[model samples]
Target: MVEIKTPMLPSNKPLIVGKIDVRVGDHVEQGQVICQIETAKGNHQIKATEAGTIAEILVEEGREVVANDVLMVIDEQGKIQPEQQSESNKEILTTVPTDTVQHHLEKDLLIIGAGPGGYVAAIYASKRGMDVAIAERKKLGGTCLNIGCIPTKSMVQSAHLFELLNEMDLFGIEGDFHASINMEKVLQRKDEVVDTLVSGIEYLLNKNKVTVLQGTAHFLSDTEVQVGSTIIKAKNIIIATGSVAASLRVEGCDLPGVIDSTAALDLHEVPDSLVVIGGGVIGLEFAFIYNTFGSKVHVVEFQKSLLPMLDADAGKFIEGICKEKHIQTSTSSKVISIKQTVEGEYIVTYEKDGTTSYTIADKVLMSTGRRANTNGLGLEHTSIKTNKRTGEILVDEYEQTNVPHIYAIGDVSSKVKLAHLASQQGCVAVDHMLVGKHPISDTNVPSVVYTNPEIATVGYTEQALKEQGIPYKVSRFDFSANGRALTMNQTEGFVKLLASEDGTLLGAVICGPDASSLIAGVTVAMTNGVTVEQLTQTIFAHPTTSEAIREAALALIGRGIHQ
Candidate 1:
C-alpha cells in the first residue's frame, strides 16, 4: 500500500486542518490540496504529492497533525488502502522543509511575535548562546504592552486612584471631591507607558545581540521564515503571536460604536454611558474603570455569574462591590443585537431569562474573549496541528508542537492566557529547546485578575475538588479580622483555603484589596505541597495582610488565632 502525505508548502508552517481537505475514498492526484493549515503567520492549503485514493483519514479536521504521517494509505494500484500510518513514522514524516528551506547554520533560533513570550523567549535563547532573530509585524511588546494588559492596567490604575480619592470623604476628609478626567492626558500617559516598555524590549533585544526584523513574518518553509522579502533561516522557531479579541457574533457587531477591548483602550474620550457585554475579567475591570470615570456602566454576562471560571465566592464579592459602586451587572444575559441610533448612540438589545430588553449607550464595549492569533502566517505549508474550535497550538509538556523543531507557547497554545503564564511558558519552551526539559506544570500555573478587588488563584478550587470527588476541608479568614486591613480601611475580602483530608493545602482564593498579590504565597505553598500545619507554625509579620493567609491556614485545622 502507498501512503499519501500532505507536502509542506513553501511557507514552512503547519497544516491547520490535518487532512481536512481530503477524505477517505477520495481520489487525489499529485499536488492536490489535501489539508488546510493555519499558524500565527497565516493560513495555507497543503497539497498531496502522491497520486492515490485516500484509504483512511487519520486525523480530524482542525486537529494538529505531524509531517510524513501518512494521512491515508492507498493501495499499490493507487486505490484506498484503509490503514492509518504508524506512530513511529509520524516524527520522521513531520513535513518540516529542512531540505528545501535553506538553513543559516549560525542562526539557531528565530521567533515570531514580540509579546511577553516572544521577548522573554528571545532573551532566554540568547542567554543560551543561540543566534536569535525576532520578526514582529507591529510594535514590540505585542498586544500586552501596546494594547492589552499593560495599557489596560494603566487605565485601571487611573480609575483606582480616582475611586480612592472619591472615597476620601469616608475617612473624615472633606474637600472638593469632584474631579474632571482629561482623556487626552490619560491616553498620552498610556502611550508613554507603551512606548517606554516597547523601547525597553528593543533595548533588551539589541543588548542581547538578538536581531529584530520589522515586518509581518510568514513561514516560507519549515526551516525558513520570510519577513517581507528577506528570508531568515534558523534551526528552531518559536511562535508566540499571541491572541486577539474574540469577535462577538451579535448583530451590528461591526458597527462603529461597538468596540472590542483593544479599541476601548484607545479611547481619548470617555463616553457619558457605556455598555459592556461580557462580565469576565476584562469586562468587569473595564466596567469598574469607566464607572470610576463617572460613566454610567452596565455589564451583561451570558454566564450565570460574572467570572464564573473563578471561585464563585470571589465573583460574589466583586458583584457586591460593583453593586455598591452603582455598576449594574446582569447575569445570565446575552446580547442579541446592537444598532447605531440616529442620535449618535448605540441601541443594544439583549435578553435575560428569555425576556428581551433594550438599552441605549454612548459607547459599547465587547469583552467577550480572545481567539488565538493564527491567521495569515501560513500554516498550511507544514504538518503542524491545532484544535479547530480554538485555533490554539497543540503542544506537549515540553512545549513541542507537532513539528519538533517548531514550538508554540503563550496565548497561541491556550495553556493559560495570563501574561505571567505566557512568560513562564516561554521559559519552559526555551528550556526544553535547549536542554530537553519541560519547566512548567499546568497545576503550578498562577493566574491573576486585575480588578478593583483583584482576583488571583493557583491550582484547584473547592468546586473542582467536589467535581473530582476529592475529599477536602475548607477554611476561611476575612480581612476585616486583620489589623492591617482595618488600618487601610479596605477590609472587604477574605482568604479561603481548601486542603486535602489530611490538611495539606490544595488551593486557595482571595478577593479583596491586593487579592491578586496575596495569591502568590498561597500558590507557592500549594505548588510545593505546603501543609496547613506548617503554614500555621510559620511566623507572619504583625498587622499585615499576609497574616490573613496564615490565619486562613490555621482556621483549616480549627486553630486560627486572629480569625
Candidate 2:
C-alpha cells in the first residue's frame, strides 16, 4: 500500500486541506493532482505519487492538516487483502482467530496472538518458505499496538506538542498564542496514527501470503490446537499472548470512577482532578500526560520512590521534576480504599507511616502493574511447563519451552514485557529452527518510560552493581550543560554512564530530551562490546543531544572535555 502524506510546503507550518480531488476506490495514475492544500504561502496542489486505487481518504475539506499526516492510503496494484474478523463478545476473546486458506489443519508454523512477536514471526517465517498461520481473537495488532506502547506514546507526543505551543515565547515566536488540548481531535489523531500502522502491518502480512485466522484457539494436545471447530496440527507453535493491565483489589476499586490503563486512554473529558494509584512506568507516564493536559494530578505510590524498576538516581530526579511541575505525590503510602461521593467525586483513602489520610478526585487510576496473560489457552491440555508463581511460559535462550516444538516469546514468556524485545525473541526462535542454533542475548534491552523528560536505561543500574558487589566507575553529564538542550529549552535531566575499572561499558541511563532515541546508540555499543575508549574516539555531531553521550563517555575515561 502507498501512503500519500501531506507535503512540506514552502512555509513549514500546518496547512488546511482545501479540497480533495479524489475519492475512495478511485484509481488514478502517478502525478495526478489529488487535492489542494491551503498554506501560509498559498494553495498547493497535492499530487498522487503512485498509481493505485485510493483505499482511504483521511482528511476532509477545511481540516487543518500537518506534514506527514496520512492524507490517503492507496491500495497498490496486486496487493492482497487479509481476511477480516470482528468479535462481538468480549467475554470469549481469549482464543485466537481460526480462519484458514486450505481448510485442512496441518501447517508449518502456528502462532497465537497477532502482536509484535507473533506477527513479526509469521512474516519472517513465511519469507523463509514456511507455511505460517497466525490466529488473533482480538484486533490484528495486539495490546501493544492498540493499547499499550503505541497508544501511550501517541498521547505523549500530543501532550508534548501542547506544552511546546504554550512555551512558544521561549522560541521568540511573537504572537498572542493560547494552546489547549482539544481531546476529541487529539483522540482522532491518535487513532489515525494507530490505524495507519495497523493497516501497514496487515498489508505486510497479506503480501507475505501468511494465512490469517480469527477466533479463540487452544491446545488440543502438544502438537495440535483447537480454533473454533477446526483442529490445527503444526510442526512448531509459538505462543505470543501478551499481558493486560492489572487492577488493584482494594475496596471500592470496582467503582465507576476507578479505571485501569485502558480506561485511562479513552477518558473523553479531562477530569478536574485525578489520583494515580501506582508510581511505576504506566502510572508516571499517565500522571505526567494528564498533568500537562491541565488536570489537578496527584500520584500515590506504594513504593518509597517513583519508577521502582529504574535506578534510584533517575527516580529521585524525576520526583524533583514532578514537584517543580506542581504534581502532588505521596510515597510509601498504600491505598486503603476508594469511595465515590453522592456528588460523583471520589475520595481516596491511604495509610502512610501509621497514619491514614484521604484525598479526593474526579477519577482514580489503578496503575499498579501487569501480570502474564496466559488465560484460556488450555495449557493443561499439554505437558508444557509454566512458571507456577507468575504463570509465564518457561522458555530457554532460544525461546523454546520445555516442549521443544512449542516456543513462547513475549509477555507470555517473561515479566520484562517490551514490544521490541518480543519481536527480537521471535526472530531468534525462527532462526534457531532454520539453523539448529540461534540465541540472542537480551542483556542490553533498553527500557523507556514516556514521561516528560523521558527516562531510558540499558544494561545495569548502579543500584544493581552495588547489590552484586561489582566494582564500577561512574560518570554523569547534565543536559543543563549541553548547548543543544539549551537551544531546545529542555535542559532538565542528565545522562549517567557506568563502566568497569578496565574501561568497559557496564550500563547507562538517560533522562532528558531524545532519551528514547539516544539510548539506541548506547545499546548498540554495549551489544557489540564497545569500550569507553573506543566510543570517545568516534566523533559526534556538535550542538546535538547525542554529544552528551560522548561527553559522558569521556568522563568515564577521566578525559572530560565540555563537562
Candidate 3:
C-alpha cells in the first residue's frame, strides 16, 4: 500500500484541497495530476509518484491539509497486505478504537501553539530537565516566522534596495541602472529565508529533546490536553495560540481583489494602484513597500494621523515624508465601502471631514490589525478566564491564568503581541513555573515601525508624562545636523528625549535611519534605571547614527556641544 500525502509548500500555512482528479477504484499512472491544492501564492497540482489503483481517498476537496498529511492510499496490483504499522504512522492515524482502552502520555509540561512563546518555553523547560511536549496546528515558527515579521521584513529589505538603486546618484555613484521589481524572485527569496529560519528552530527543538505533536490541541482538563486523538497528561500547560488578522465588515470587503496582510505578502504582480485601509504599522510598511515598487499607494486612516500609537511629532514627520514620496494619505477618514468594477478595478469610498471621496485602485489591502485566537481551545471546560472586551486570555503578572496549573502567554494573553515580547514572556513563564515567581513587566518594551526612515521608542512618551501629570524636560537632536545623516543623505527625522527634572531618563524616541537598532541603547538604560547624566557620560562613536542618542542626552543637561 502506498500512502499519498500532501507535499510541503513554501508557506507554513495549510493548503486547501481544490479539485480531486481521481476516485477510488480508478487506475492512475505515475506523474499524473491527482489533485489541485490552493496555496497563498497560487494554485498547485498534486501529482502521483507511482502508478497504482486508488484504494481509498483519505481527504476530500475543500479540506485544509498540512505537509505530510495523508490524502489517499493506492494499492499496487490491487493487493492488500496486513503489516505492522510504524510508530509515526500510528501517530498520524490518531483516532483510537472506542472499545480499546485510551492511552495517555505523561509529561512535565505541555505547550499548545508552537509559536515563539510555546517553543521558547519548551526549550527553556527542557533545559531545566523537565520533559516538554509542544502541539502545533501549523508550522513550528508560527505567524511571526512564517508570515508576520520575517517575511514582511524580507520584502521591506527588497523594496529598500530597489529604491536605493534608483537613487544611486545621490551617493556620488553615477551609473545608468535599469531596475524593475521582480516579485517572483522577491517572493522566492522570502520563502528561502523563512524556510531556513524554520529549519533552524526545528533543529533547536529536536536538540533539546522536546516532543513535537502536529495537530490542533484542546483542553481536556486543567492539566490535560487532547492533540488529535492522543491524550497528554501534563503537570502544567501553557496556552500560546497567537492571533488572527481582523476582518472588515464593510461592503465589498469579501471581494476577490480585496485581501488581508497575509495575501498582500504573496502577491505575484505589483498592482498599478493599492488602497490601504489602515494607517497602522502594518499598513504603513506595506504602503511604503508597494509605493517603492512603483505602485500608486493611498492610505486611508480612521485616525487623524499616521501611526496613531506613536508620538504626534513622529506621525507628522512620517506623514510629511509620505507626501514627499508621492504616497497619498487621507487622515481622519473612515472607509465607507469598496466596490469592484467590471474591469477588475476597485473603487474605495471613504469619508473625510464629513465629505465622501473615492479612489480607484487595482487592489485593496486591509491592514486593520489582529485579535487573539482562542476560539476552539475548549477553554470553557476549564476554569481559564478571558477578557470580555479584547477576547484575550487573562493572566497574572507571572503569566498564569485563574487555574494555577494552566498558563497563557503571547498574543493569547492580554499583553503586547510582539514576537520578542512573546519570547521574553515565555522565558519568564517557564522560570515562574519551574524555579520561582519572577514577574516580567511590559513598561520598557521597545516598539519599532519598519517604515522608510524607521521609528522606535522605549519607556514613556511625552504625552503620557503630561497625561499622568509627571514633570518632565524635553531635549531634541535632529538627524539633519548629524554628520552621518548628512553623509548618508537620509536625514529626515530627529531623536527626542524626555527626561525628569532630576536627570532621570524618562523616555526616548528616534525617527531616523537605524532607529530600530538605536532604540536598544535607550531600552537598556531604561531597564537598568539609568539617568540622563549617566547616558551623557557614556561615549558614543563619532559620525554614527547612535551618536544622536548621546547628543540628545547631553542636550537635556545643557551641554550640547555639536548642536
lDDT of 1 by residue, 22-87 (tens): 667777766567765554334444556576777776667777655455665654366334465456
What's the candidate order when arranged by decreasing TM-score?
Answer: 3, 2, 1
- Ranked by lDDT, the better of candidates 1 and 2 is 2
List the candidate 3 regions with Cα displacement exceeding 4 Å.
Answer: 1-103
TM-score, model 2 to reference: 0.83
| lDDT per residue (tens digit) for residues 200-319 in model 3 | 676578778899888788887787888876799999889999999887789999999999999999999999999999999999999999999989999999999999887788888899
lDDT of each: 0.80, 0.87, 0.88
- lDDT over C-alpha atoms for residue 171 of model 1: 83
Q: What digit string (tens of lDDT, one per residue) describes model 2 on residues 1-563?
A: 89999754545667899878988987676767898888665666677878778999999998997768899988777232223213532334434334543245789999998999999999999999999999888877899888888888889998998888867777788797667778898787777777656755765787788887777788879998887666788999999988877778999999999999888888889999999999999999999999999999999999899988888988998899899988999999999999999999999999999999999999999998888888899999999999999888999999999988999999999778899999999988998878868787777899998998999999998999999999999999999999999999999999999999998888999999999999999999999999999999989998899999999999988898887
User: Model 2 scores what on Cα lDDT?
Assistant: 0.87
Every model's TM-score: 0.80, 0.83, 0.84
Cα shift from native, residue 94, model 3 (Å)? 12
